[model samples]
Target: MENKKAIKLIDKILENLDATGINTDALIDDIKELRTYALEQQVPLVVKVLRLTYEHIEANQSFLIPILEDENDEELAEAQEVESTPVESLKYLIALTRNLNNKMNISDLREYKELLMAY
Candidate 1:
């Protein structure tokens, strides 16, 4: 059950990537790091997922995260969050992918490791 859900998350990311053509590099690094942490700390499966995801988000801070104060208009800021650069988006995706590889029941990790080279 947990494996299914974890795979679903990866699928979700891949789908989003296909639609948006986003890159995924920095996110992969975060994911891999979080997996190590999860195993060492004995975190629960669900918590591990969330933690890894959060770390992925955190790893691409400049990209995934926006500078709210830079918004020119308050209404626009309030109504819609700005999207990051395409490169930034890809980095975020990579981070998430690596996290998935570490925490999920994945068999071929080397391929994932190789794919996480660019953002």
Candidate 2:
């Protein structure tokens, strides 16, 4: 349930990015690349969040190293990073979900992503 909520939250962040004018095409490419990487390594979604979380932390100008730090902190940092995207990063969210590890339902996933990206 928590991971589901977090995923939705990421969708909202992406939406905001779009609204703000981020280069979504590039974001999509990045997500696709990430997904491919995840598949190749058989990594789970939570760990996939590792890259996004790291990106967010660096953007925040924090001095902490992702691999050496806390999980909760990483998740929150990734959530906050979602706020920095241009207008809406909805596409990125879609890409991430499409690459999920089969732990959650797709319908529920879309609903939250839609709701969060609504604004």
Q: What's the TM-score of every candidate structure? A: 0.27, 0.28
lDDT of 1 by residue, 60-106 (tens): 54234322222467776554445555443343443443344364333
Clash pairs detected, candidate 1: 23-90, 24-94, 25-94, 27-94, 27-95, 27-96, 28-94, 28-95, 31-99
- For each candidate, what is the lDDT? 0.43, 0.43
lDDT of 1 at 74: 79
The weakest ten consecutive residues by lDDT in model 1 span 105-114
lDDT string, candidate 2, 1-119, tens digits? 13454455456545545564344444444445544544555655433453453354345433121111124587766765755342323343343454455544344344433333332
lDDT for 33 (candidate 1): 50
| Candidate 2 global Cα RMSD | 13.7
Lowest lDDT 10-residue stretch of candidate 2 = 61-70
User: Residue 89 in model 1: shift from native, Å?
Assistant: 15
User: Alpha carbon lDDT of residue 47, candidate 2?
Assistant: 38
Off by over 4 Å in 2: 22-49, 56-90, 98-119
